[model samples]
Target: LMEEGYFEPNNESGRNRDVYQFLDGVAAHSKHMQQEGEARRLLRNLIFIFEENDLSQLRNRISELILYFKSQYPGKKDLPYIQQLKGMLREWESDLKWGHLGFNAFHVHHLRLGFYKGEIFTETPRMDRDVAPLLALMQQVKPTIVTVALDPEGSGPDTHYKVLQTVSQALRIYQEEEKPNKLEVWGYRNVWYRFHPSEVTTLIPVSLNSMAVMEAAFETCFGSQREASFPSYELDGPFSRLSRKILVEQYQDIKCCLGREFFNESKHLRLRASHGMVYLKKMTPDEFFQTSRELKKSTENIE
Candidate 1:
């Protein structure tokens, strides 16, 4: 995906003819067709709808987005994205129920913010729509721990990095205005990035039982990502498999250091030790800011 040098210009006329036919009765037959297949079809043929030139139209509630699609396409059973979204919803709802959200509230807010619509999280004359939700969340939740991903290779330069920047601004504002209590940031990385031995503050052992549980949960939910259209690193398989591979690789690295004899001798702990470990870097609010600063180059006029 990151090829340098000039590439041949795309011929508009040579565009695939199927694009036209696919989108022809999309509004009508989308209900009759498979949700997953229809979602992929929409993505292939009409992704440009999301890239509307108008910035205002680009920003919307997920509800509004769904409504817009429903209005645009009549007689739709549901978009494939809808089915996957439902799966995610079911997972979260089930988790909330299992965890017992008695006194604590579990709120999931969608900012729907992006740089593609020319949105900037950096200092400007006015506040960015993206950072506002995060700022509000801080005031509303008064969370003891705020979690953010450290990975930086998402859509581009990691949509996550951009998200982190905005979050930094939000935390900055929250600190200045609210004078919040002691807060910690739990920084995480998927397969894209990881904490080095020197940086890790904690380690969670990944056991075979835990791996089975994770695999079950992942398979039951996350259908959209399990079968992503534009896959990660051109991988045809699910990211879960790649993640497991990485975990095992890390375990091997650890096994080399500690000596295979140490693990081979441990009767009860051997299985889990062979599986691998999860590294965690817990940071304070100040350390959180410093980490993001180190992650990015150039200065922002946030002050």
Candidate 2:
């Protein structure tokens, strides 16, 4: 659940906030949490952020950002941006609900390649090298539920599809070796893309309060996105705003079909929007692997 670039700083609403600014905000929030006497807990979930390369010439800019953070935080002046970012992530992880359950974790992969909008497959070696360790990690965790972005070809950036392929391949390898077990691969989409109502199998309604919390987390943890570099002109506000609209729309659609009385009588329905987070059809591990392989082969043919 991590990306190489911190945020799309070019977004108009983001105001050109860079990675350094984002990490600063995250560090500040971590300090605030510490002062509040919050307990520190381990996180089980893994988050990988590839840092060696990025689009828009971000590698050099990230180097500059590291120096900026080093200068800003006297105590951490000697450390690099990646280290500082890791520390901040650890702190944020501590504040997550998963942290309370001692199941939060993250990693910054030092992969050799950077992410170009449509060149993920062209850099096959990097992708395959990255996937080997991931396969091993998956074997260790043996998770039953693996969630991934449901991005289609030519939608958003190509990185999303590459990630989906990598995870799917890893799962395929792991399943071949281990005992047969039930596995569910959940496909999700966010602001960059969306799942059609007909394509969705799950809808987790979110409350206004929960939305606020999510926004706060974004504000605190994603300083870089505060002033985005590549702001979307099509949208009026941040991605969160888009998310709210989508969730509300989904909730309304459901209510309309089920009748307003159904929502009025349910306590949870009263607080939640008309629609919630939408997921695409769930796929079994074998199904996902086959789909990913087919997509990979198609890409190869085109290349």
Candidate 3:
């Protein structure tokens, strides 16, 4: 599409030229494919093309294609292309399945966390209602390690900060009753914000192959967020790409500060151009709870 002049970089203004050209190209392609009786081929080509891009872009393109196909030939499932497309869509949906709580059930099952049914906080913020269930869940799990985003006010979204506070509150309640064997809290941030070198206590190295796998998982698992309404203004690509860039930059910083031998000597660390590092900050349960409480109070004072 770029070579054919169907798409170009928006040098004039900060707009998504890719998205506009993509939708146009798909519409034209669908029409041509239908006339040529190559709808199945078109579907195959779409799947192949999107695999090269990020999850959000792929999701958006797929959604547009699906709508185009349905409108072009409604109630015609008996057709070969239509049947194949429907089957493909069914498989895709199944693979990217999510629970009512907006979490991948497959991930939860793999982690062996028990599921609890509850209403998702969409419109109104229900602190007590949300915290109560999480507290109960924490007591049941008795997890030694708890990880939450270190998102502050005015971060990517209010939901991230809210979730952190809720988890912290639940942990505080759980600790009051019983202490886990080795309780630890890990604060992590991605895309919107990242921890400075001074703030990071842990630097975990990731292999190039693992990074590729992570991108694939994001594309396949987060089906709903494929077409984000509020994408990052600074980053033109998907969230996964932003995360990758951050990790790589961190690794580069470490190599510049510490000699290459540091990574070479470490048995667990592997160095490569494609390899990346994730930074994390460690905190005590009480410290996390206190931070959460302070955040809550600060927000309240502002209101």
Candidate 4:
């Protein structure tokens, strides 16, 4: 409005000058007047002063009047200005909380998942040395419950024995520390490392069998390994015992017991089946058991 000339400055000149005229105005000091002409002339002079740049004097007069009012009501007992200010502050705070921060209940769940996945470690592995910060973050985020699903052989140590050893050490550490909330591991068959519900972390390994049998079974039931691979699960590590069972279930059109029910063939299932057979079949006992003491000593001697 200021830019569009909806309002005019008292001192504006030339092209910007757009003035309004008022007639029959009464002067505030008319009580001291003796003639009507004096009153009219005084009002005309006041209008001319407003046109001439007398805004500063008018502002000073307004300020003096405000000071008088404040002095009369020092606590502002009858004014709603305090309430208006409070309402503005509350609106600003609400905008900051909902609009700027963009935080909600779901964030806590995501944070809990990220915490369990060691995504924080991925972000800053050095922070692993001081878990207090992570615990504090967990508390601040405040997840109701955290569920962790781990295929340990796929993501644990680089190889099977090291994974076992690491899990063992972790189990011992958990036992010693006796931490409150725990972990759970899941798979098809029975595992060597089992956890009591009371434990902080649970280790579950479902043993399975070779992929060749699974592929052969997929071929048998679905007429192609692709269909069979969807229902079949191959040995993920040397310890998996359900590999044969997974293959048999796939081939015989029997229901798979390892969580999945529907069999929609996709690239991942095919690749996993093909890759599982290609790699797992090629592995010999010696290659799989790299941590054997005799083999390690032989390897060292070779080095």
Local accuracy of candidate 2 as per-residue lDDT tens digits, 1-303: 015332332221221122223334445765554423221111111112333233345545556766866666422323333554544444443334233233323322223223322232434424447677777677767788888886755566566776776777677778888855678988788767766777677766666777776766654544445555455554656656666677777777767777877655666753434235444668887777766766666755643
Error of 1 at 146 (Å): 1.1
Model 1 sits at a Cα RMSD from the real structure of 14.9
lDDT of 1 at 30: 54
Model 4 C-alpha lDDT per residue in residues 133-251, reported as the tens digit of each score: 44445445443332222123323322333323333333334434544343333221222222222322222221233344433333222211222222323443332234444334433
Q: Mind giving the per-residue lDDT tens digits that candidate 1 earns over 1-303?
A: 003211112222212222222233333455333344333333322223343323344345345766756675322345554434444344333332232222111244434453423222322322456778778878998888888887643333345677777777898788889876788888877666666767878666687776676665455335445665445673467767767776777777777777877677777674434587777789988898988887764334333
Alpha-carbon shift of residue 280 in model 3 (angstroms): 0.9
User: Could you give candidate 3's per-residue lDDT for residues 100-207 as a string of tens digits?
Assistant: 123332233221111211213222334466777777777777788899998875666666776776787678778887867689999998888778889878988877
Better of 2 and 4 by TM-score: 2
**Per-candidate count of clashing residue pairs (backbone under 3 Å):** 0, 27, 1, 14
What TM-score should be assigned to candidate 3? Answer: 0.58
User: Which candidate number has the best TM-score?
Assistant: 2
Q: In candidate 3, which residue pairs clash?
A: 56-226
Worst 10 residues of 3 by lDDT: 110-119
Residue 177 deviation, candidate 3, in Å?
A: 1.3
- Give stretches of model 1 more than 4 Å off: 1-106, 114-126, 153-157, 261-274, 298-303
Task: Point out the higher-scoring one by lDDT: 1 or 3.
Answer: 3
Candidates' C-alpha lDDT: 0.56, 0.54, 0.59, 0.30
